[model samples]
Target: MTGAAPATIVFGAVYATVVGLCVGSFLNVVAWRLPRGESIVRPRSRCPHCSASIAARDNVPLLSFVILRGRCRTCGESIAWRYPAVEAGSGVLWLASWLVFGPTFDGLLAAVFCSLMLVLAIIDASHLLLPDPLTWGGIGVGLAGSFAVSWTTPRDALFGAAVGAGGLLLLIGLWYLLRRVRGMGLGDVKMLAAVGAFLGVGGTLLTLFLASLIGALAGLLLMVRGRLGWSSRLPFGVFLAMGAVVSLFFGPRLIAAYASLL
Candidate 1:
């Protein structure tokens, strides 16, 4: 609005970035611990190498990593680069959401989507496993968020969930019928369901298209490098996260562009 002050906007942007970085730190803990059935809330963050409880000063996200020279203060063990990278990436994503979507419920939802996508991508890439709690919990939160945001209504969210999960479920069933083996993990179906809950049917479809294309190209590249075989399994959820995040921010434009080409 013309009445909005530049200073206010700047403050909001800074606040969002700070919050994102903090949340990113928590997300890292979740990615590392949730898969192992550890309580994320309990026991403070510790060094994976030395099991020394990290001090609050050393837990300050990106700054701490740099301050500590990327080594554990207790054991001199090297810290993973992903820690600071996630924090930086998350801050950027939050800033992008604020700039692009503005300070509104839509922006908040966008930020949340980015957060979920980040952790999901990290977990899937590292473990090749997508935990049910996250997928299921994400779906519930996304559906709830729809009532607050203008874009996706309750009916649309439900339809989207069906379309996203149903499409994958069908493929899973067909693969089982034909090959007598599970072709994909149920985690994927649930993940898409969560995506659909936030994005709606069209966005869900767009995400699928983008993830498939990207995954295929990646697979081909790996095959060429002799790192992947025909029977090799790719962590598909990571690509899905990439696609969903792209769709969340740019789906309408991409969809229109594709339609024009057809």
Candidate 2:
């Protein structure tokens, strides 16, 4: 959905960025806990080194990291840089959503879309596992949201889901038939299906194209650096997340530009 510009750029930008950072912080917890079969809500966020509950003051997104000097208060252990990076990245994404979609339902959808993609990207990159809760929950939310959003209809959303998963499944079959080895797992298939539910057919197709292109470039770079072999597996879901983010932001413009040429 294309949303009009926000009424006030300054307020909207600030609001989006702050909320986004907070969301990112929470997602960091989700990414760590969901895969490890831990409750994100039960135990408060703690320093891994000391198991000390992080104070509310110390959990204020990027500032906390800076104020703490990237160290645990209780133990003085170094914090992972990933935390602040995710917050900053998420802030940018949230600001981008506000700029692109304004403060409409469409904007909210964009933010949610970005959040799902970000957390999934982190999880997949770390564990090479896309948990069922996120993928399936995303599908449910996307399809349910289809009726409320202007950009996609329920039928198109369903069709997109089918195409996203079916296309990948077909490719998997072909890869195995030719190589006698799995190039990717079913998790990637399900992840794309979630993408499709939110984006519809054209968006999903474009996402796949962008992801393939980027993934190929990354793999080639890795190979050139002797850091990867053809047999090595890269987390396809991470690339998928990147592709979906691109698709969410610019796929419509790109599609329109291409169609004009056609």
Candidate 3:
């Protein structure tokens, strides 16, 4: 059915919550293992302190955290608060997307996009790096999705990928020429391409602008408080993810506002 019936809606709500939380759990593994060049599947969830393999029953996403009192069963070591935080955050974001778009294709796309944002943000925050697998892979997925759902014409999607990749590369070159330093890393460049693949040229630009503004503000604040030096590195991927989220949810309105202001 194009629209969910009442019973279907109830089922969907429950399923979305459960699935979102479970995905969040997987995402946590991905975030932690990817940077280390380790397979997420190789080692099952274990206690960080004691290396005790977790029982399946104790891996039930948010419930497990509550039940275990956020401690490792074998060692009684406290679990990082981030585990539940990411789980709940992803679940809520997925639920919000479902509420906004229903069970339609748009909802599914938005959900995947949001999940990607979580992965991107986590990796970036941890290592100041964005993996090509996630970035370029996201671009491919977004482009394929655009065609599956007819969100963009094949021509637009192709052009978007080209413009997205090219535009950022050009900016990086210019920045290097001006400063003799790397202003944008290759990871960020790949990320912009991925953003373009999903958002098209206009949406990609909006994402860049929004990310820059947020990153600049945050950096300035840190500098003002003497918490960061002029040369201190900032997490660019986090800003990029935020920009993508803002563009995904409010690009059209923001574009209209910009036009009006101009």
lDDT of 2: 0.92
Candidate 1 has which clashing residue pairs, if any?
A: none
Name the candidate, 1 or 2, with the larger lDDT value: 2
Return the TM-score for candidate 1, rounded to 2 decimals.
Answer: 0.95
- Candidate 2 residues lying further than 4 Å off, grouped into runs, are 1-7
**Candidate 2: Cα lDDT at 39:** 97
Q: Kindly report the root-mean-square deviation of model 2 from the true structure over all alpha carbons.
A: 2.0
How many residue-pair clashes does candidate 1 contain? 0
Compared with the true structure, what per-residue lDDT tens digits does model 2 show for residues 102-187?
Answer: 77788899899999999999999999999999999988998988888878889988998999999999988998999887888999
What lDDT is reached at residue 245 by model 3? Answer: 84
| Colliding pairs, model 3 | none
Positional deviation of 228 in candidate 2, in angstroms? 1.0
What are the runs in model 3 whose C-alpha is more than 4 Å off? 1-10
Q: Write the per-residue lDDT of candidate 3 for residues 76-195, one digit (tens) a residue.
A: 999999999999988987887787677888788888888998888999998999998899898888788877653455567667777867877897798778877676688988887887
Per-residue lDDT of candidate 1, residues 206-247 (tens digit): 998899899989999999999997767799999999999999
